[model samples]
Target: MVSKQAGVDYTETFSPVVKMTTIRTLISIVVKQGWKIYQLDVNNAFLHGDLHEEVYMDAPQGLAVASSRLVCKLKKSLYGLKQASRQWYDKLTEALHSRGFEHSVEDYSLFYKKSANSSVYVAVYVDDIVLTGTNLVEINNLKSFLHDTFKIKDLGQLHYFLGFELLYREDGVLISQRKFTTELLKEFECLSYTAVTAPLECNLKLQAAEGPLTDPTHYRKLVGKLNFLTHTRMDIAYSVQHLSQFMQDPREPHLKATIHVLRYLKNDPILGIFISNVPDFNLRAYCDSDWAACPDTRKSVSGYIVMLGDSPISWKSKKQATVSLSSAEAEYRSIRMVVGELIWLRRILIEFNVPCDTLTHVYCDSQAAVHIARNPVFHERTKHIEVDCHFVRNSLQDGSITLPCFHY
Candidate 1:
């Protein structure tokens, strides 16, 4: 369909949506504050966007037209148009701005409106929206307004949205993709496969050209779905990350390891992160790296998890861009990556009126890396990673974060 459109019809196709991190962060806060969650769906969402560019389309197949040569001039955006999403987002922004809602600079898709007794947060994923706040009446009124403005359909209470299933409990809210996982398992014929205790084998190393090549299409499709599952299932994050490296030219060993992850999912598809109701907003992070983990490129893998109190809101397992000469350098670079996330998360929390005056604790496994980050002294060992050292040290110096060594 994109091939059918001309260059003048659309220029920008990139549309920002609410981030998964922001969604998790807000859900954690909602559970902590014991606020209500609501869901809204916009009917024919793309059709509401007003078009600014001059465009013409062929008339409908059954329409009674005066001539076959006549084309219809477009005034509103329609589905399949490249610019529909951007136009609709602009229209939604205007409508919300008129109602005192201010879009968050931290996250454009997130809009917040505050009054004397209430603060309402609305997260937009295109047409689907997740609304939450302390005031029930104000939330209902906003719902009414959105319906009147966009012909919205109220789904009521947020049990499911974006393939994630929410389970409210006495302790906290449980978010999972059990239904999605089940379908994934069944579709891949892994439902009846033997389950594994772990997603990947200990000390597992996959080579790009170790074995005969397999179907790249099948391997890529399975890996893509597994990547989406990692949103709720952090346990598979590392395995998915490792498996994705062989997508372009997958081999037999790569497919086997991928199937191992599928069996791990079959072991317990219901396993998910639990956002607790603890009244703590402190940010704590743990970062570590596997030196020379990749046998092919000898690139170390960086893994980190960020916790807001006991709830894990953000995490990642990625391969480093460059080879590190030492384990300490790899660890130092790992900490540097998390510091960026910590600062950005602090900004988001501050916007939510949460006090983040205390320094965040960043625990690392390598004492040498911690020493390198804390000490300003430079040596041959720290020369290559001076840029990373400066970043971590600056964050440490400003009281934004503290580097603490964790004993194994």
Candidate 2:
């Protein structure tokens, strides 16, 4: 679809989207509380948005118009207009606000209405809405209101939205992208390829100049698809992150490694994260780093996973911006990364009116790093990472996070 001219035909195309982590967290909450979760679709959602800026379009064929050169002025948003999404979001937000739903400061797409007896959470991603709450009557009222306002279509119990396919079992909710994965493999002719045990090879060192150059566009598309799969499949997170570095000028070795990742996906495309229905809601975090893992840049790779009860809601595998002098420093930097995530997650939980413990436990295997966080006496060795030390230490002092030494 061709988009309208920016700044001329329209302005302000930005629209907030609900974070995948928030979606998973909500699912976990639903599973634990036995709350009813439903999906809503706004029919021709963009068309419901009222246009503030004057937009004109040529009349379509078969339209009875006085003159052929005469153009039609648009009173509402259209499919190809640049400002369509923002307009629709503004309209929806107004509707929800009028109904006493407050916007979440942490995630703009999340709107919640809380009362003494009932609470309703509505998350919006464009036209798709995921609604979960304790009150079924209120939910039905909401459905009727949306239907009257924007012709909302009730999709019933949330089985699929976006690319994720959710399975609501007795134990918990299972999320995966089996359909998307199958289509991706079929598109690339990798559906029949032999499955592999792992996403990447052990001790596989890929260089920017290694092997002959391949089609950079094809390599980028493969990497991009794999990166999306990482949302549900954390097993391929590090591999996809590693492959993304070669997007500018991918080489033959890079393509082969990417194919290896695809083969790994072939092994079990249905495998995904299962948010269990555990009673506990306390948050926990684990972080680790591989010192000088990148041969090309000598930069450390930081990996961390944040869990709510037994369900993993957020995780990331990223290369550090700068090289660390020591392994402890790398580990400390990783701790800092996770501490930030922990703080944000706690804020989100607070918005949900969920009680989080005073101090969320953060585990690290490196005793040196743990000592650095607690003692603050290793000035000579910790000066380079003083910023990270200060951030983590401040969180510790304020009782936001605790760095516990754990080996496993």
Candidate 3:
């Protein structure tokens, strides 16, 4: 248990996270090489680091300091300290670098060593580490090294991490978070609640202004937990994004909507994204938008989903920052945003030795948006749009993306 702080103990406590693209890329490489991925846990990970900051703590009830007025000075980082994560990261990097492992330029948390015949890669997400390599000997050697320095547990083969349940198959690794969903349901006391097929009703619209919440703290906590669950549940992405807008002044209706989501999860607890064994390396994306979807601000809702071959890897649903004049403009903006994600995914794939073509396919449901992307002639209709919105046109001209008119 953390002691109560008299004042603000931390100014900014955000930790750097490895992007989903990096994780997917690493998994894809592991699949291609038919390599085994192992999981390791650094016991009391934060305590293993030496603290640089002068942090003090009050003594526990039973334990007393020998010095009458002396306080406990921290020699190592504690869980709630502001600089704990950063200090741990710095220490781990120095140790890994000294052992001849080089970090990836695109992803700092990824360190690797490669030779003409063999390669080994390690991806660190806080304390949990996923080790992948070409040979089992090298993997075991590295595991022994980490164990000697820190208290490490070798979880035979990678089965779970960060709420993801991994199933290793002869074809490829299947990733899901069904176990995590079950735990979430039991925690919220919604394990036996009636479920709904869809996360939200087709016509149901959420707004910022709603009724008063009975308990704002409880509502906010539910929203935060659901947000983390989105790591493997893409179906809840839109619903969670809509519900998150009410954190400031959540009303009873808002809480009900959030609870409705929980009920839906109770029914289809096993549903999640499935990564398959398809060998196709083609990059494809779909972008869609609902014009003036938010009733409060009249702003549009833009969403996109990107896939590599047969697996859906990335998706997002967000409220547009600006009010779009028409559905075509909103769709165009959505397509532009998805293209950026696709390009980055392509780069990360290339880093993993996956072969990708020069141009990626981006599908849009709006014909007008397709016309805008394919045509260079900008008329008065599109002149009001910011210049950055024309990135789709630039991508088309440079043969980086193929914007095709598609239905749904």
On the 0 to 100 scale, the lDDT of residue 24 in model 3 is 68
TM-score of each: 0.96, 0.95, 0.91
What lDDT tens digits, residue by residue, belong to model 1 across residues 1-408? 224454777777667799999999999988888788899999999999988887678887799999988888888998888889999999999999998999898999999998877798999999999999887887898999999999999998998989989999899989999999999999999988999999999888888877876467888999999999999988899899999998888988888898899999999999889999988889999998999899999999999999999999999999999999999889888998899889899999876767899999999989988898888897999877746447889899989998765887
Error of 3 at 246 (Å): 1.1
User: How would you encode candidate 2's per-residue C-alpha lDDT over 38-131 as one tens digit per residue?
Assistant: 9999999998888998788888778899987788888878888888899999999999999999999999999999999889999999999999
Best by the TM-score measure: 1
Q: For each candidate, what is the lDDT?
A: 0.89, 0.89, 0.80
lDDT of 2 at 227: 88
Selected candidate, larger TM-score, 2 vs 3: 2
- Positional deviation of 209 in candidate 1, in angstroms? 1.8
By TM-score, the candidates rank as 1, 2, 3
Q: Whose lDDT is higher: candidate 1's or candidate 3's?
A: 1
Model 2 poorest ten-residue lDDT run: 1-10
Cα distance off (Å), candidate 2, residue 334: 0.6
